[model samples]
Target: MHIAVILKQVPDLVEEVEVDSQGTDIDRDSVKWKLNEFDDHALEQAVLLKESSGAEVTAVALAADGVDQLLYAAVARGVDRAIRVTTASARTDAPAAAAALAGVLADMGVDLVLTGVQAVDDLHGQLAPILATRLGWPHVSVVSRVSLEGTEAEVTQEYSGGRMATLEVDLPAVLGVQAAPRPPRYVPISRLRQVMASAELGSAAAAAAAPALGSTVTRLAAPPQGQGAQMLEGRPEAVAEQIVALLRERGLVEA
Candidate 1:
């Protein structure tokens, strides 16, 4: 089986974030970059599937410069090969990103594409579905488990209210891996170094074919400052009355 796992390089949560002088982009110099946390689980799943079924795993990333660290990390984690699609644009819009990925997958003849439910930075959670649509493949989102048998694959999906539904999908499918499915394996430093030194890393030059399929983002702004807290005084009943009144005023409770 040939499995393709999509990965993204994102700003490390541990590093402090700063907006650029123009306020339209982040300060790249100050931020430390790493693989999107959820993508790590997706990569782990790919590796596990390869180990159990003797499948070949290919890890792909669409990123700008300075993403070698993230790609090296994926290699260390057991991905058989790595491909980087370099984009000059700093914008991380989901549709445009998905279109680029679809192009790459088209060239690679991917049989299965696995990705995280969402990336931490943008948190759009749209890539897998968008890519599936673009590629004309069956898509299953929030999938917790997947098992391949013969030409079909069984997927366990998590739905609302903690419910799960098992589905059987044919080959050439896309799945959005949910966080609750399974814990990703840890990559030891020794293996990391070995893979970093030995893995075949390749890059695809940015496509100049046409303008991005779609673009949006009229304006960007920071979140509003939080308000100061207020203390509730008096007896429990009195405080309850105040809370109810506040809730009613805010339209959270019918009065």
Candidate 2:
């Protein structure tokens, strides 16, 4: 079986984020990027399948800052191929990403596709469904486990409150992977460096124009800071009276 794992880089939250001058996005120039954590899990699942079932795995990502290194790392982790989709802008809405990916992936004739359930940048968690819609393929999200069987795939879907369900999806489906069965494996820095020097990444241009479904951000700003807590000292009776007085002052209780 052939599996295509979609990848994306997101701002490393450890680094402080600054708003760009445009007020609609973060300052890209000041940010350090890393592979989206969920995407890492998706890659792990693909690699696991490759190891267990002898499946061919392809890692695809948009051309962006540090993307070449990320693809090389995937190569070190057992991916068979890496492709970078060339786009006018690295930062795109989910619809645009899905459109570009679906166009290239459709021609590859992959048996299955996997991606993170959501990107930290957008958190829409809609890329899989959108890509599936564009490609006219079946799709499922919040998948935690996947196993291949002939032309179909069985997956464990996770729901809210720690609920899970097993589903069988026909081949040529897309899945939003919430996690792999196991934690993502580690690749040594030496191995990654070697792959970076030797591996070649295929490239493709962005597909047709993105639809008009995306929204325009008008403004962006930090949330307003609020007054900090006021400590209530003294006896329990005094604290209770203070609380009642404060609530009354705020119109939260009968005067």
Candidate 3:
């Protein structure tokens, strides 16, 4: 089966982040980018399927600061091909982004599509389902594992409250990868360099992409700094009294 893996580059939270003066979005300056963690898992799954069944795997990403780095990385990890979808802005709206992605998948006529359950930047967890909606295909979310069975797929889905169920799903479907069947295999830097030199990455613009759904941010603000705890080191009785006094001072306890 031919598979398409939707990819995205997200802010690397390991580094410090800043907001722009407008306070409506993150400041792109000085921001480090990486593949969304779950998308890495999805890529791994696609590679695994490619290795075992010789499935043709293609990866697509939206235009962004580090998209070429990401596409080359996918190639180094054994994706058969890579495509970059052009976007008007670095921060494409979620619904509009999904529409563009769905447009790509439909054009490719892929049998199945895989993507991270959610992106770190948005955490909406809606892209794959939206793709399914746009394509009128079956969709599943929070998938932990998948095994192909003679044109059908047996999938293990995880739910909150420690619940899980395995389902038999038909093809031409979308899966939101909650966890990869295995930890993503690392591609060597040398291999990435080799792929970058040899691979031909394609680009496309989604003709059907539309304006994003109505959502406006009035302001963006940093969270309040946390207050360090005050340790009351003393006798138990003294500590208890100090706690009560402190509570009283704060009006947490009656004087």
Candidate 4:
């Protein structure tokens, strides 16, 4: 089996984020980058499947600035090969990105493509389904478990209302994995250094040849600040009344 895992490089979750003065994009000068957290789980799942089923796992990424570190990490995590789709802009919009990826996968002839359900930085959670639609393949999102038998895969996914469902999908399918489904394996320092030194990282030509989807960003804004908490003081009955009044005032309770 030839499995392709889509990885994304994102701002380090630990770092402090500040919007650019224009408020159009993040301030890149002070930001640190790392592999997308959920993508790590997707990579781990692909590696585990390779170990168990002797499948060949290839890690692919839409190469943004400062993505070499992420490619090395994927190699250390047990991806047999790595491909980078070099692009000038790190567009966070999922559909445009997926369209570019569809072109790359078309040439690679991948049997299965796995990606994180959502990127921590953007949380779009739409890439996998969009990619599947572009490729005309079956897609399963929010997958918690995946088991392969012969040429078919059984995928267990979480749904609304805490519901769970399983489905069987054939090859040439896309699966969007959630974090809790499988914990990521640690990449030893030794292995990490080895991959950094020896892994073959190349950019596919198709990525450059593909036309831009012409996506536009009208404006960006931060969420409103949270209100200060009120302290209820006095007797138990008085405090309860005050709490109820506050809830009602905030439209959180019926009057």
Candidate topping lDDT: 2
Q: What is the per-residue lDDT of model 3 for residues 1-255, given as tens digits with 9 covering 90 to 100?
A: 899998887788999888887887788776888898989999998898898888999999887767989999999999999999986654555577787777778888899899988886663336888888888988898998877777777888998899999998889899989888799998899999999999999998877745555667877777776876878999999999999999999999789
In the order shown, the candidates' Cα RMSDs to the true structure are 5.9, 6.2, 6.0, 5.5
| Model with the higher TM-score, candidate 3 or 4 | 3
Query: In candidate 3, what residue range of length 10 has the lowest lDDT sum?
Result: 87-96
The order of the candidates by TM-score, greatest first, is: 2, 3, 4, 1
lDDT of each: 0.78, 0.89, 0.85, 0.80
Off by over 4 Å in 4: 88-92, 121-125, 207-216, 226-255
Tens-place lDDT digits, model 2, residues 182-201: 99999999998888888899
* Runs with alpha carbons beyond 4 Å of true place in candidate 1: 88-91, 123-125, 205-219, 226-255
True-structure lDDT of candidate 1: 0.78
Error of 4 at 60 (Å): 0.4
Off by over 4 Å in 2: 123-125, 227-255
Task: Name the candidate, 1 or 3, with the larger TM-score value.
Answer: 3
- Give candidate 3's TM-score: 0.85
Q: Which whole-number lDDT from 0 to 100 does residue 225 have in model 4?
A: 66
lDDT at 197 for candidate 1?
80
Tens digits of per-residue lDDT, candidate 4, 118-229, equal 8755534378898899899999988888878988889988989999988999988999988535588888899889888887797884453333556545555677768766
Ranking by lDDT: 2, 3, 4, 1
